[model samples]
Target: MPSSWTVLAVITVLTIYFCKNKRYRWFYIFAKTFRRDFRGFIVYVKTAITARLAKIRNETVVSVFESLVKKHPEKAAFLFEDETWTYAELNKFCNKIARYFRNEGYQKGDCIALMLENRPEYVGIWLGLSKIGVVTALINTNLTNDPLVHSVLAGKCKTIIFGSLYANVVKNVAKDLGFKSFYQFHESTTKEDFEVLPEFIDLRSKLSNISGDILSSRERVLADIQDPLLYIYTSGTTGLPKAAVVTSIRYMFAARGMTFVLRLKSNDVLYTPLPLYHSAGGMLGAGQAVLSGITVALRKKFSASNYWKDCAKYNCTVAQYIGEICRYILVAHNNVEPVKHPVRAILGNGLRPQLWKQFTEKFKIKEVYELYGATEGIANMINLDNQVGAVGFIPWHARWAYPVSLVKCNENTGEPLRDENGHCMECGINEPGLLIGKINQKKSIFAFQGYADQKATEKKILHNVFHDGDSYFNSGDVLVNDEYGYFYFRDRTGDTFRWKGENVSTAEVEAVISNLTQLSDTVVFGVEIPNSEGRAGMAAIVDAHNSLDLHLLSNSIKNNLPSYAVPMFIRVMNSVPLTGTFKLKKIELQADGYDINKVNDKIYFYDTKLKGYAELTKDIYEKIGNGTMNL
Candidate 1:
């Protein structure tokens, strides 16, 4: 061989020659393949490694609260009818309430149920309990006896704090329930006679006796970052609502994700009209306020007509919304000048892709942080960095990554098919798949509090598939991951039914129907239409005693839903069936499919020609079945 320098010179000359020739360049590329793979691996490794580093600690919220109290004591924390609470006053009040709970045989980890409306006291009680490490289970105030009772009992709450407005409902249910203590906030809309318990104590009187010293002492009882903070109930596709144990770690993640992802600041004020019982209102909205030390303007219930006015009044920089809320707001008359408020951003879940651009442009919202997360599911997606209509990507991790698989769904049974390997293969980019959260024992962060039924909880969990001895949380939601790895929501798996070559979610359709205030309640489902390839969209609605404004109702749905998704048949009912927990019972409605001859209830059909829905006469029903009168 030649000298070593000669060999090096020869190699360099060969490399340069190869680089210049396109065909020979392949050899050079082949030689650098390992380096390319190594560089890509480094990027993947870095993203996976630094994923959880930016997560906020649970104590950060309370620390921020303390800072706000010191920096801006007189700033309003909450405003309600004839009442306003300053940050300092609210913090002190919450501390005192927490102390009272601690002194009254309550300890960290104990569950306390809160059944109150959107009021100042509700905030105080929730914040106070959170400070003391008490897991507060929020009961839906609209839920009647059995569901109301089941939720409280399911959460295993020993004590309950309820608004006096729900005293009658609570009293009827409490006698059978084994709650240790009951504290009633002295605020009620009803003056009707109701039984008052002798043991029941007024919240105001208890707070009066607790001095500022007690409040300060109680602040020392700070909870660890991983401790349980909330137990929120989510109604699954089937069964009663199950309580999902929300840890401080998850709450912190939510707070940090909302702040950095949505770019919320201390100066930004958020308008939230969603119920506090829901995760969007509690963790996403209220949690953001606590962590960012931002002001939250609360509304008891959503009112499309009043939504813009409230945003202007509160000088809201951002607003929280759900899919249904957005649809309702869109249906309202378009404003002459959309950029009316100081609002710059809107954040929430389930906003449809079709309505995404319209909502942003019409409302003058600069950004839409369409986040995706179940109340209990560990995996979360935030549209950080202003990626519209797409849930942001999750960094790769062996344990925490959400691998989506397009399951082979059976046409007859409507269930997914499994392979011999048991583990489902991931779908190609842009294809919808059932999103499953990978569970690793070391990194698994969530636990389902579950409903009263343990079997119900077990059914939701899938174990031992990907790794010989691993488990994963079944989110029950279908999602699509694009080439960029950003996820887009498809539909809830079990809730969506095939109809006319398209999948229809009753939740999505009901969202459109529920916007009409004329209906007391609405349930949408798929009913088998004669000669149809799949189920046809149908709606059962509890109309007001007076006749329904069919013209207005049809117009609302047409404006909101696509032609294929809109209910072809509308059945008017005296009442819509619901579970004890206020969840719409669709099973009974689905079973009771439309039959004009057998059904006593009046049915109507959407008359595309009439530009409105009309009564379903026997002749019309037959014509629809015969395809003579198209829906």
Candidate 2:
């Protein structure tokens, strides 16, 4: 029972002693660990709060577009070679097209097929369809014959729009497919009244007659957030492309999430050379810009020499990329002033961890929002509040989750094998796994627009896993999750093949080879070596028409890939046959693999002793096949 003052003095002394000695000692260690986790938790909480707020208000993408038109009328909405369109101009253009669609008896939920390239008309058609509540099926222009005909008929499109440039491609396939009507938009003509071609309606005249003020009626057309807005086709690893029905809700979510992740503002200009047909260009790049009222600089295709020049010319603050595009840009000749552009950030997927630091340092880009998402998959990974080289984290959800598992391959056959329980176990951290999105009836959000071959669609749907009754979408991609829950891309399951005791992905090897300008498109696969333990890496390339610079090509591969992963044989071909969707047709190439005696193509083998590729003669082929030559 000490006096109150004496007790207070003792407590103060104890506090001071603890602060000076034991407490401070523990505080340093605690703060180091706790601060990182606490900050991560804060980010998680903030994201959750924002998501909840968005969900409560139910803000749709259509509403956001309308608001942009109202708020920023003078800002650039779309740009062509010499013409620039403001939001006001774009809104009017879209309404005119929408009114034409309505006048032609098109209704809500009707599907319209658009076969066009990267152009101003593409944006107009997209916005017009959105205003009319019609689902726009974006068809890849490169697709030909059956696949092309199949994709359009599969969506059950009421109308099809094609660029005048693709008229030949459409004419080759259209007669066979029973399309209701064909509409053409000619890029060469700027006339208000366009010439009407036989069996086709000109869009220009329809657009000229409609009033711009008709956009006020958009409120009635866009009343529902969950309505289907776009149908994006994703090529199946097995056969035909399957259309993924994208809703307005998903588009709105992507726009909001990307805007926050990229920290975009109205003044920011996003440069995209990727085609609008892909999700990366349409939903991520264009959608994000529209939502944030930012300007977008569109290019028909990517050119390495002209890329930095474009950025500088446009004063581009942001750019989007895919993995191959970045590698190609890096392979270009080094410049003393590589960081001359105004680009502050870049956002996209497929950027390899190895090139992360080098690319950022060279370009002087402060932020790299490397994001991950499938064209149709519900789960998306954004590296907003995380480090570079990581695809960011997704918290565990019992109902809906992507539980990745490594496919165990046979040493002899190279085919995936199942365990005794018939269940695949996931790989350890940083190891590759075939990512499978667990389908729980309670939480699944993706809807597959029926494929032309419905039976083909059924194959993509995996069923009865982890329970008596369950289903999931097979992503066909190998991925690994680190301890922090960041997903890292490994390889596509079908693309991974055994090569001299190593698993090789054509994409990984092709990515390395594409760095060589002498090779326009390279396809990597395994060619059987007689009496070998596994298949050896072989590459078939479309030469860049210059003398084969074997030394430069070999050096590039050696720098990027492991020794075993490098191609042992190289075949030079005039052209690489690609599917309608621009994806390399590997099945035929793998079938006709590297038998120099049988095949007509000029074959070259990597001469380790010579340090360059040399012509493969019958004698050398026999020696290599018999394991006499140490390849």
lDDT against the true structure, each candidate: 0.68, 0.69
- Model 2 per-residue lDDT tens digits across residues 1-631: 8999999999999889878845655555445445444544554444445545545676566667778889989989766556777888877778777878877888788889998888766877877877878889998765665557767877878778988777766777778776667888776566653444677777766567777675566433754666777888765453345677777666655666676667677778888887788788888878865666888888887787777788888878888887656766776636545547999888877677777887888888788888766776644566654366776555332113234333444323223445576654445657765666654333223343323356755666666544446555666666666545566765555655654322455665676677664455888887776644446788998874745677788886765455767798898888888889898877678778878767788888989998778899999988987867867
Question: RMSD in angstroms, all models?
Answer: 10.3, 11.3
Give the total clashing residue pairs for model 1.
1
- By summed lDDT, which 10 consecutive residues of candidate 1 come out lowest? 395-404
Q: How do all models score by TM-score? A: 0.70, 0.70
Superposed model 2: Cα runs more than 4 Å off = 1-58, 189-197, 215-223, 333-339, 384-389, 394-424, 440-458, 495-631
* Residue-pair clashes, model 2: 1
Off by over 4 Å in 1: 1-64, 67-72, 79-84, 188-199, 214-222, 335-339, 385-416, 444-457, 495-631
